[model samples]
Target: MVYREMETDAEMAMFVKCFWMSDSQNDEGIHTVLPDGYFDLIFYRIDNNLNRIFLTGTWTIPVDVPFTKNTSHFGIRFKLIASEYIFRESIERIIDTSTNLPLHYWNVSDETFENLETFSIEMGRIIERFIPDYTEIDRRKFSLMGCLYDNHGDISVAELSERVGWSSRQINRWFNNQFGLPLKTFANILKCHHAYRQIAQGRFIPESAYYDQAHFIKEIKRYTGYTPKELFELKNDRFLQLSTHDNG
Candidate 1:
């Protein structure tokens, strides 16, 4: 498989993490996708022809996705705030799964997948049209999310609430309603995602947030079904993200 990614600019950074594309080589295979606490809007194709478009909800655990020979995918990975200001709908119903979106949802065409650079620019325009006014975003929610990403989900729920000036009860309720998961679960996913990046870079040690090595191992296994060492080994390309990360 061949994979590539492009980072978003500052203007779109608050709503999008990155734009990525993947191509299945000449053989059918399974791609193990790890949880990164982000949702996606995917445009899938076969033989370079637009097949379909779909929206994915936030993932809490790894999912194995199968691809046919010569298939390709282009996707936009979104932050939490996009649900309110960009997509403007609740994703709670699709948690851990995805639903097919109308092919014309974004007026997507076969031309949109022609190249990553063009796709990235086009998506920025699309997202901007969805939220012409930046103030449509809630200040407290924006601050809370910024802090979470900055700290890699290291802060506690209470501290997050106090920092954002929002109550914990309200925060949890909002999380559950929007993402079908609590704040801590999402935070843990982000924390585990950071650990994956470290492991991919050939670092085997646990992060400082874990109580100890054993605690870190358990948490890694819980979300990724592999200990840090196993993930680092990269046997048979079991983890697709780590396998293609450098290629990206």
Candidate 2:
């Protein structure tokens, strides 16, 4: 397994988290992908030619992906708000699904798509052509999202309402319309991601985010479908480990 990640350039950082690629020839069997409140554009190839292009939407549960021999994957991990710029359709249509991408949806020239070498470089070009100017984005919403991220999804709805000067109902409606989930659900996903990072690093503390040990275990299980111990003890968990490292 050769897994690596590169930070997005300044221009693309507003909507993209990073560019990641993996080349694994081993028979690692089934690898589970955990929910992390983000979307991904994945390109998989078996022997250098594109085998499939998938656009994955936000997930609230774990997904299992089977590894194949001599397969390589390149992906663009998009930020939470990226769907607003990348897709014209409602996000609710794609939640928890990996939809195949039509060639027309790529918004790139056929020659450019065929010549895709480095995903990071090619993604930058695609984003440059499709995304609107950054200044056009809602700065207030972006700032509120930053606050939520900085706190690792620990903030309350009332507090967020006050901070954003919007009613809780309004915020929930907007989030549902754009993200296909309520604000609280999105926050819980982020919290789970944060907790997973702590667990992956062997530094989890019960009191860090939960009321009690039982609550911690239940929440972890709710998001990941596995107890912390089982998740940690799994040996063929390269995808889980990579998601934790990259998303953290």
Candidate 3:
């Protein structure tokens, strides 16, 4: 597989995490997707054929994604706030799964995937135009997302509420309604995801994001269905994100 990723600029940073593309290179196999606390809008093709689009909701657990020969995927990984400010729809119903979108959803098409560089620019323009015109940005929710991602979800719910000036109940209520999970669970997924990068680099011991080794191991297994050791092996490229750690 050939995977490439591009982080968004400061202007779009609040909404988009990155734009990524992957080609299976004629190798057909299954890749395990571990939750990284972000949702994605993906455009892909198999056997170099028709362009297909899908929107994925926040994941609470691992999911197996199978790809066929000549498959290429292009996607925008979005921050939690995008659900309200960009997509403007509740993703609660699609949690742990994906929903198909129209072929030209957001005016994205097969031609957009012709060049990765152009794709990035075009998508950024789309987001730039849409968010400012159609959506009302919420400062509290935006700040909350920034804190969560910046801290790698290491902070407690109480602390987050205090910092963002939002009540714990309201924050979690928003999380469940928009992302289909509680704030703590999403935070744990983010924490575990950062730990996943460390584990991929052959570091297994618990870091600051975890309370201890036991807690670290439990969280890793909870989201990934693998212990740190297993993830380190990256057996058969099972953990897709780990495999792309270098590129990421």
How would you encode candidate 2's per-residue C-alpha lDDT over 43-74 as one tens digit per residue?
87776656778888899988888877778777
Q: Which ten-residue region of model 2 has the weakest summed lDDT?
A: 107-116
Winning candidate number (TM-score): 1
- Cα lDDT tens digits for candidate 3, 1-248: 77778889997998899999888897888888888999999988876655689999999888988987788999999998898888888999999999999876887756677767878988998988767543456778888999999999999888888988999999999999998999999989999888877787788889888778998898899998989999888744777688667333
Preferred candidate (TM-score higher): 2 or 3: 3
Listed per candidate, the RMSD to the true structure in angstroms reads 1.6, 3.1, 1.8
Clashing residue pairs, candidate 3? Answer: none
Model 1 stretches astray by more than 4 angstroms: 244-248
Worst 10 residues of 3 by lDDT: 129-138
TM-score of each: 0.95, 0.87, 0.95
Q: Give lDDT: candidate 1, residue 217.
A: 91
